[model samples]
Target: MDEALLRSLTPSVLAVLVRRGADFAAAEDAVQEALVEAVRHWPDDPPRDAKGWLVTVAWRKFIDTTRADAARRRREDRVEEEPPPGPASSVDDTLQLYFLCAHPSLTPSSAVALTLRAVGGLTTRQIAEAYLVPEATMAQRISRAKRTVSGVRLDRPGDVATVLRVLYLVFNEGYSGDVDLAAEAIRLTRQLAAAIDHPEVAGLLALMLLHHARRAARTAPDGSLVPLAEQDRSRWDTKAIAEGIGILQKALARDRLGEFQAQAAIAALHADAPTAGETDWAQIVEWYDELAGLVDSPVVLLNRAVAIGEAHGPRAGLAALAELDDSLPRHTAVAAYLHEREGDLTKAAALYAEAAHKATNLPERDHLTRQAARLNAKRRA
Candidate 1:
């Protein structure tokens, strides 16, 4: 069975059911059943029309489920009469499904889960594994998300920003378990970009491409974090970087200047450099200023300080960091780097040890611990 093909057909199949008067939750469940049946039987006897087969099976399943539930008898009459078997309507409902799954009513985590299940065609187990959560917990999260948006009208205008934010969240997850969420996010974003002509959408796609281009060099073979400055530039995907730059240029020309566009500009500048020393830190700092104006996020501030350290000096970076709350995630890490740059090895070592203690992930904690150890050894020598 072609798994990718099945996943690609999922949204349209679910859309067809919804258009035929099925509620969001039931239609999704029926479609999932159809997918399972396809996996079980398609190898021995593949259907001539994959999507049509899925729709027929799923619609039947929905009808059977409605009939089985006494409380849903009232809905039975509306769906009892099945439409003639054929291709679903040519009008693309997939885009609307994207908007619905990313509805503002749902929390960020809920929206991410629902989008993965309904739009990305991922199983709850797959999502759970990717997020490092139990399958039961993910199931409840998805169920609650479906219920939250079930009452929303299909034709309601969706906030594009919300949808983009969810996609960005997915991209940032990188990869884990069986799901390459970063790749999945790119696929979904590409679909959305095709469906709608928006600069921010293009900007986001550009940003993901540029960032993904460096994935191969983001870590050492032993899984230790490789700071961008020390990464082997030869490992970066030049093709992806070129594509991202072209897209970002077009988006920037549109003059919308959204946060994603600003961020992409910074990424593009980094990608353009042959070495860390060659990077245009001043341009990046300017872009960060624009980003700070667009989104008031602590993470952005933290990043801007790093750029300041490169563009001006470690003292300037430390001054900027001092304005931020010390409790901010990565605050100690940033301070440690700035102090090291300023030649205060003792203070840097102490800060690195502190940051290591506060690190949330194993890779990060290990990296910080190594930084402290390296600095401490150098100080002793």
Candidate 2:
């Protein structure tokens, strides 16, 4: 059985049931049941039309479940006569599904979970494993999310920005357990891009590809984090980089510059560089300026400060950093780097130690500690 094919068909199949008057929760559950059946039987006897098979099986499952429920007596009348097994309707509701899964009514975590299950075609257990949470916990989160959107009608358009934000959140999760959420987010975003003609969608896909292209060199053999400037360029995926650059170029040409596009521009700039020293920091600072204007985020400005430090001088970067709140994440680390560049080894070492103490994860803390040690040893020499 082609698992990818099955997952690809899941959203459209679930959408068919929902369009045919099934509630979102019941329809999603029924679609999952259909997927299980496919996994069990498709190996011995694959259907000619996968989507149609799923739609038929899922609709029947929904009807059966609705009929069995005492509280859903009124819903039974609508699902009493199951549609005959035939080709599923070609009316794609995947875009609508994306918007619904990212509904503002749901919390960010719930939205990500629901998008993975209902849109990305992932199982609750898979999502649970990826998030390092209990299966029961993830199940409850998805259940609540489905219930929250159950009453919402898919008659109006959804907020595209919300959908993009949810996808970005998924991408930022990177990888955990058996699920590479970043890859899953890319796949789902690709699906969304196919459904909608939005430049931001294309921009997001480009950004994911560019970032993912460098995954092989992001860590050392000891699983230690490697800074971008130190990563081996030979390890990068050239194919993915080329593809990302192409997509980004097309999106930029459309003249609809959103935050994602601006971000992709920065990623593309990094990917374009053949060596760390050859990076166009000035251009990157300009992109960061554009990104800051688009989002008004402190993190964006923080990053811009790094680019400014590289583009101009360490003192200039320090000047930019001083104007912002020092409480931002990674603020101390950036300060350390800038101080070190300004030939203030003692101050840099102290700041690195402080950043390590504030680190949120083990790898980051270890990396920062190593930086402090290196600076202190240099001073001793």
Candidate 3:
């Protein structure tokens, strides 16, 4: 009856099917069908062993589908001898599932969708709603992803960095519809950290926790974006922040510096601050330097500019920003903030208006529009 429990068991169940010689695509479909049946029946007739129940039902479903398909006739003979229903294997297949779902053959969007569905146990409609896309469009994307990875061998190890990137992408999506993707990403990352002793894995989990701890204060009552410096720190989850800092500290001790660890180091600094004005921007700028060395992303440079503005002065930040491409997303907004910090009200207002026109999301556009209006009003007064 516990939906989260069922979803959590999904990847392992599918892995069992794949291990038993079932193809990935068919095994995934069977697992989904079993999940639907569980939702319909589990509340009224709960099973003694949830994972075993799912494996039995899904394997039968796989066999039935394979037998019906002439193209899969070769698989029908092997699956005809159904494995006896019993307790699920003690061996954890969740890690392999993570690798398989984040396989490099698929596009980023496709990988995210497949990971959510096959590993996260989200339905296609749920994923579509979370992404604010049409169900059919999401369905096609997931289908293509499955086909792309169908030929891939599950026995081989997968790239850890690719898996981390996929998880980070999920975390950055925040929350929408019925899924809190950020929390889901944290859960999966925690699972990954337990399975592997990698510092980057721990680092990513820490970063997610630190960011998620501030979710409550990230928006106003009317769903308006609240700048980090302006957020009410009283609302932040102290426990999560503490845990994040602890995890980050251990990862940092490992000395295997990675992008996520660098980012978490920055987040820990922010959380350590008693107030916005007390933030250690100089240390943060140093961390940004590390992050810049890890990746040459323009967004990272833009963020470093903001840190420079805080650590040095507005003019210094402007100088750093001047080296980046003007067409980058949020560049104008960053420029506007720097100009405002320099007390150039007219330039700030105009830049804010321009940024609002180019904003990608509703909340951001509304926030930028308000900034522009506030500055325009100030100029008139």
Candidate 4:
């Protein structure tokens, strides 16, 4: 069976059930049942029209479920009559589904989980594995999310910013277990971009492509984190970078700048450079300024400190860093880098060790620890 085909068709099939009067939660459950049937039977007897098959099976499943539940008998009248089986309606409610899954009523974690399950066509187990949570925990989260948005009609527009933020959260997850959430996020974003003509959407896609292009070099052979400056540029995916640049240029040309577009511009500038020394830090600092203006986020300012250090001087970067709260995540690491650039190895080494102790993940902690060790060894020599 072509697992990809089933996943790709899941949203459309579920949408058909909802458009036919099924509630969001029940329709999604039925679609999942249909998928299981397909996986079990498709290998021996594949249908000529995969989508039409899924729609039929899923609709039947929905009808069966609605009739069987005593409390949902009232809903049976709405779905009693089934549409004649034929080619599935080309009217794509996938976009509407995207908006619903990303509805503002849901928390960020709930939205991300629902998007992966309903929009990204991922199983609760798959999503749970990706996030390192138990399957039952993810199932409850998704169930609650579905109920929260079940009463919501798709007659109006959804907050695109919310949807983008959800997708961004997915991308940041990178990969784990059986799922590469980053790749799944890129796929779902591409689907959204095709359905809508929004600059920010294109900007987000460009950003993901550019960042993904460097995934191969983000880690050393031993799975340690490699800073962008130290990464081997040769390992970067030039094709993805080129595509991202092309998309970003078009989005930027639209003159509707957003935070993602600004971030992509910074990524594009880095991708354009031949080496770390050749990077146009001045342009990057400018982009960071634009990003800061677009989103009042201290994290952006913290990053800007690094760019400021590269563009102006170590002292300037440290000054910018000093303005932010010292309790901010990665604040110590950034200070360490700036101090190292300023030739204060003693302070830098101490800061690196401090940052390592505060690191959230194993790889990052190891990288920071190594930085401190390297500087300490240098001092001894």
Candidate 3 C-alpha lDDT tens digits along 1-381:
798899988988998888888999999999999999999999999999998899999998998888888455544365688765435542347788889899998899999999999989999999999999999999999999999999998877788999999999999999999889999899888878887889999999999999999999999999999999999999999999999999999999989999999999999999999899999999999999999999889999999999999999999999999999999999999999999999999999999999999999999999999999999999999
Instruction: Arrange candidates by TM-score, descending.
Output: 2, 4, 3, 1
Q: Least accurate stretch of 10 residues (summed lDDT) in model 1?
A: 83-92
Candidate 4, residue 214: how far the Cα is off, in Å: 0.5
Worst 10 residues of 2 by lDDT: 83-92
lDDT of 1: 0.93
After TM-score superposition, the amount by which residue 71's alpha carbon in candidate 2 deviates from its true location, in angstroms, is 8.7
Clashing pairs in model 1, backbone N/Cα/C closer than 3 A:
none
Stretches of candidate 4 exceeding 4 Å from the true structure: 70-78, 84-92
TM-score of each: 0.94, 0.97, 0.95, 0.96
lDDT string, candidate 4, 173-192, tens digits: 99989899999999998888
Regions of candidate 2 where Cα sits further than 4 Å from its true position? 70-76, 84-91
User: Per-residue alpha-carbon lDDT of model 1 for 1-381, expressed as tens digits?
Assistant: 789899988888999998888999999999999999999999999999998899999999998888777455544355678976445442358888999999988999999999999988899999999999999999999999999999998986588899999999999998999899999999888888887788999999999999999999999999999999999999999999999999999999989989998999999999999999999999999999999999989999999999999999999999999899989999999999999999999999999999999999998999999999999999999
lDDT of each: 0.93, 0.92, 0.93, 0.92
Question: Under the 3 Å rule for N, CA and C atoms, how many clashes does model 1 have?
Answer: 0
How far residue 96's Cα lies from its native spot in candidate 2, in Å, is 0.3
